[model samples]
Target: MLDLTTGAVLWCALTGLLFTGLWLWYDRRDHARLAALRHRATFHCIRCGNLYAAPRAEEPAPCPKCGHENTRLKF
Candidate 1:
């Protein structure tokens, strides 16, 4: 019957939509994590000899232990 076929099509469409949404959500989460990792900059503290990381590469990062501001390390 036409009604039975319509129900089957509707079910398939909903299932496809659910899967697509999940895939997009996971992909976006992974990309954000990768971007955060790439943006991190390393810093070394002279007062306490602590090594740390900051969100940006150019900005100076304050040491967590000694509160001394340090510039990002060069290669």
Candidate 2:
């Protein structure tokens, strides 16, 4: 029978809790990073003169209107 009252069980629970906390922290960090990148990116299409916003990862991507390459605005 598996004993839930043993030190092994306690250690396992603690490890699980630690990993869960770490995962949550990293998830929040990634979300913040993505949000910042999204805000930093301002795309402008010279071909169609269309201006839009996109994520940094999607920079140098095609414009939604004319399918032309977009230029990212820098601070």
Candidate 3:
């Protein structure tokens, strides 16, 4: 019952809508994951003022902030 020209247009529209929805969903999910990671406890170097977060409590780590060779205690 549908004309060939109409069918082609419909198919293109549906495909475009599907791709747009997928892209939005992916972007939102990625943003959520980054937000959660930022909530973790990270330390900043007093000398260089760099931000560093460790997975676990360990020895001193170098300050990525100022490129200092010394490790600062993480709280």
Best by the TM-score measure: 1
lDDT string, candidate 2, 1-75, tens digits: 657679788888999999999999999999988777656578888898898877678778788899998769776
TM-score of 3: 0.52
Predictions: Cα RMSD each: 2.8, 5.8, 6.3
Q: How would you encode candidate 1's per-residue C-alpha lDDT over 1-73 as one tens digit per residue?
A: 4698899999999999999999999999999889988999888897888999988855788898988988888
> What TM-score, computed on C-alpha atoms, does each candidate reach?
0.66, 0.47, 0.52
User: Clash pairs of candidate 3?
Assistant: 50-65
- True-structure lDDT of candidate 3: 0.69
Output the TM-score of candidate 1: 0.66
Any idea what lDDT model 2 has?
0.83
In order, the Cα lDDT scores of the candidates are 0.89, 0.83, 0.69
Judged by lDDT against the true structure, how good is candidate 1?
Answer: 0.89
1 versus 3: better lDDT goes to: 1
Candidate 1 Cα misplacement greater than 4 A, ranges: 1-5, 29-37
Ranking of all predicted structures according to lDDT, beginning with the best and ending with the worst: 1, 2, 3
Where does candidate 2 have its weakest 10-residue lDDT segment?
A: 33-42
Best candidate per lDDT, number?
A: 1
